[model samples]
Target: MKKFLVPLCLFLASMAYSQDDLLNSLDSTQVDGKTPVTAFKALQIVTLQSTKMAAKKEFYFVVSHRFGTVKDGFDSFFGLDNATTKLGGIYGVTDWLSVSLSRHTLNKMYETGLKYRLARQDDHFPVDIVGYSVADINSFLEKDQYPGLEFKHRLTYVQQLLISRKFTEKLSFELVPSFIHKNLYNPDIERDNQFSFGGGGRYKITKRLSVNLEYMHNFDKPDFYKNPLSVGLDIETGGHVFQLIFTNSQAMNESGYVTNAAGDWGKGDFFFGFNLYRVF
Candidate 1:
């Protein structure tokens, strides 16, 4: 309870000061482009999923690694000594649709999801819209720990709309409206069905390198968990996109990061992570 006191105070203070809602601030800003633009090269911009998808008949293998908190300094090898990894594969069913399955070391979690395009940023559409649905199962729990635990208690689901635009060749921005549901949860700490809004962007610095930044704010998330913030550099090589990231969220999947982010950016409590994707 003592440990949570500080975060609760901070959360209350933030809410009082945050008069402007994040999602409402982003009114439709049209870019000066006549042709359809390729907004980003990768499927995700740091923590926010981008509108990019694999080509039809193409498949992508993903490797994601998140280290422990860097606050422990050299004693923990700057977080390298304790790390969690996620390995997943994504396959394109069609040009506009894709499916994914992955497992993460954290919570012994398994995740599966799909991404489908609803609209493209072109002559007719002002923004690119993609729909994403995901499911998560926590395999780390045991019947011995909780005598009454059930299988449904370990499940979570998420749905999101990824809206993005390529304002210019060097710049692109995205907004994500997310809905998350947990089968079992503590009513006082957090709600069963959670809602969060996220947005991010990529700016091309040079030919093959870009800077990415994103932030997620949960309207219903508890104060013990801080909102997730991520910044990274995307290196676009010929075969893959390598993302070097620093984030306050240790969880790689949507459900974990959205609801259970456990790091505090104010104290340098963050994780060093990377997302690597190889297309075949």
Candidate 2:
């Protein structure tokens, strides 16, 4: 599956490149050489990716963590005993296109993804449209368990269309249509291909602080698992965007969280986490 990385990136990049002519024409939308920077300040509205992208030639490093359920007061050290971490880096291939790679402690997951902007919001456009796709490999699975398990079985793919609108400098909203495919799954438990729709928004509290909310609903997952609902606070400081999070989903990857959100909000099962990004 690693062999598909270059080809997949090239394919998506080409598609983004094809829209260059239209984007160039839209350059006139800028006023006094100033175009709106972004609907949101960070690369993510919460766990879900935002419409933001790294600038041309810029690179971003991100580290994220989600601790165990905070329901247990101090038994688990406030969920500190069972925390998962993800380290990732994204590079801008062009201002409108980017490539990313990340590794997570949970499931030993390795993720490779591409993000491209199809259109940027402006006076003529009502919203920003960005396409993001990711392929994750779970290296935690061992062949000893399932002799039939092949490398292909370890792969999971996700696709999302991020549509966002900035109604004001202090308010912005996004809608996401997401799809996930797992190469290995139990026929009795859930379908191999799953779909979901979600939306998120951010409200600025100050020049450097904002409150964000994100929720996702899976259409095909078992009824036992609840949809993920997350709330977070974003703080901007120089080159760093620091986010403090509270969510019902323990799995941070798109597919993992989408399909197997473990906690239930009704029971006060919540996980605390943070996502930090540094740009260079």
Candidate 3:
């Protein structure tokens, strides 16, 4: 009987130790905060990681076509020949900052420009500000001449201040105070070095579609010509953006539009323009 009793007690003690060991292992796992493995959890983690990487970079491209009547009175015999094409690219440097470059070809006229965002909207600032500079070169000007025709070669210089305010997720407005300098214009043609206080807005019609309207008025010389206004629509899909527009100004670049615009909508001159973009 004594032997049996001792064996029983030993068995019970061994079982108790085994149970304690199992509990201790579970407690250690909980304290280390290790999640249990599950198929769904694993997939959720992978999807989250992929989403984070995808948010890092974005790209876009666009091309546009413009046609209108030339206001220089050459259209009577020249057949109202005003047409242009524009190509553009935009890169997302960060979620809030972006840079863009665009090139325009208008018959013999070629122009290019760059835009940069210096500040963005935040809790403290309600408006976003941007700086832009554009230059127009008359390829038609003779380049071989010594000293060259500085006035003719350097067509226009435009510096602009852009202020944009977003009123809602789908609506926003912008104002531009622009200064323009032209070196080639005939001195006899009463002109002003400063031109165009512009304003425009964007209305989002859909998730990937929006319409924009912009206008510029030259306060320095309102009598020089008529104010230039542009209305356009943009379609954004993936890495591509398509812009369709109409305007009284046929010049593609800022310089040409500010200094060389020869169209007057009041006189029945208008143009149709479109842009197509793709990014890799």
RMSD of 3: 24.1
Give residue 114's error in model 1 in angstroms: 0.9
In candidate 3, what are the lDDT values of residues 1-280, reduced to their tens digit?
3764485466434433432222113112331244211111000010010000011255555455566553445644222355556666656566434455566666355555445656555455566666666666665556574345665545667787777666776676777788888766555664538667766777778865677777777765545566677677765444233466667777666655654455667775666666543443
lDDT of 1 by residue, 1-280 (tens): 3664485456335434434432222223344555455677788899678998776898887878899999999999999878898999999999799999999999999999999999888877789999999989999989998689998998999999999998987899999999999997888788889999988999999876899999999999877898999999997555357789999999999888877888999999999988877666
Best by TM-score: 2
Local distance difference test scores for all models: 0.85, 0.85, 0.53
lDDT for residue 232 in candidate 3, whole number 0-100: 75
| Ranking of models by TM-score | 2, 1, 3
- Each prediction's number of clashing residue pairs: 0, 0, 7
Candidate 1: residue 41 lDDT (0-100):
77
lDDT of 3 at 264: 67
Error of 2 at 94 (Å): 0.2
Question: Stretches of candidate 3 above 4 Å error?
Answer: 1-61, 70-82, 88-103, 143-148, 190-192, 221-224
TM-score of 2: 0.88
Model 1, which residues run further than 4 Å from truth?
A: 1-35
Q: Estimate each model's TM-score.
A: 0.86, 0.88, 0.64
